[model samples]
Target: MEEKIIAHMTAEALYDFTLYHTYSKFAGFLTNVLGLAVGFMGIILVVTGKSPAVSLVFYLLASAAFLCFTPVQLKLRAKKQVQLNPEFKGETEYTFDEEGITSLHDGKELSYSWGQMKKVVATPKTIGFYYEADRALIIPKMDFKDRFVPIMKLAVEHTVPGCVKVR
Candidate 1:
């Protein structure tokens, strides 16, 4: 059976999804952890008078800079997406089934088979289907009228490997 869901893409949803996607990678986690560690170590060194104050300042600033970069990147990406696909600002209709998804926008239809999906990420506010590492088709939770969540979860798990559910 085919299930249809209609939703609009909001900036907040895009930001949240982008933030999650940005920091969910192994490298991102590692970098964040390492940055914190370096900053902490720099603080300790400064307190002990073993290292120059400049060292501490540099480490702390570097960590802060890295932490601030992701949000800026996400904003740029979202802006570019909006600029490139002005039609995406409107309502999107998605048809889902055992095979894959079909999206209707501005009288144009696009289809993606199950095999084309790399992952399906379900969050409290949105469900994102990632076809590429940085690109996704986002579905807002408010769009569902019935028990679509369970249906989406089942279909995703059956079709995609490494499906993630974020609380």
Candidate 2:
């Protein structure tokens, strides 16, 4: 069995991953949900002829902008990060075994033990190995082709107990 996979990273993929990584968290999800709710409530009030105040409308617009524009901002940021960093543009190879993972890209190699990961999160389109609350090593599902399932299983098996979440 092949224990290695190679992925060609792209700006679009990076942006999508950034959006998912940010919004998949409990806090970020809740904040966006709240913004949506507030915006909808304002709309409902205006439609029902029970509009509160102009200040409330402004507040609602602000919330609506937060809900709508954050992803746009993140896209711009992700694009900039990918464009400015030479390490993210090419094919990165990840080799894994029972012990850990080694990634090689742009003539640089990095190794991380399974125990070094803070958590592993498996979503439908990506698997993320987080080293910190806000930092992760993402494996895009498409990059793995038909091997995503086995790779996910391997990650779950190797990561520490109670640190893997499948969503």
Candidate 3:
């Protein structure tokens, strides 16, 4: 609704986005596949009556790996990114209009027209204006306070319908 929405980007916010982005991709699929395969093997072993204890251990291990491995790995990656990247530790000012969005961060300015954006993804905790397949302008919901709805509305109006995902 406002001409410009400025949000301070913190290291934690960057870390959160990194973790969410990584988990939403191939890593998520791989995690599911690996977990299912191991668990299925355990089930097969149990049905065949081949060492019930060992099968149980396999099942537990599979579940643990499924629930913990990717999250831990992603967390570490996010932390490292936030710590190592200067861009992730500063304030970013975002301007939204009918034409597009412009972001000014760390004395660098980047603008993206609605047509140029690949997608606009809104999750529970963040809204990502993705211009490239692997790059995005991430806005944490926490920073938006009460202005989240207007921002989403503006995005929906300017961005392509099929490419806008708000959930």
Considering TM-score, where higher is better, how would the candidates rank from best to worst? 3, 2, 1
The CA lDDT of each predicted structure is 0.77, 0.78, 0.77
Residue by residue across 93-146, what tens digits does model 2's lDDT show? 988777777889988999888888898876556667787777777776688877
What total of clashing residue pairs does each candidate reach?
0, 0, 0
What is the C-alpha lDDT profile of model 1 across 109-165, one tens digit per residue?
988877887777876677788777777788877787794765576565556556555
Q: For every model shown, what is its TM-score relative to the native structure? A: 0.79, 0.80, 0.84
In angstroms, the error of model 2 at 111 is 0.4
Model 2: lowest-lDDT 10 consecutive positions: 51-60
Evaluate model 1: give its TM-score: 0.79
For model 2, the stretches where C-alpha displacement exceeds 4 angstroms are 40-60
Q: Model 3 segments beyond 4 Å from truth?
A: 10-12
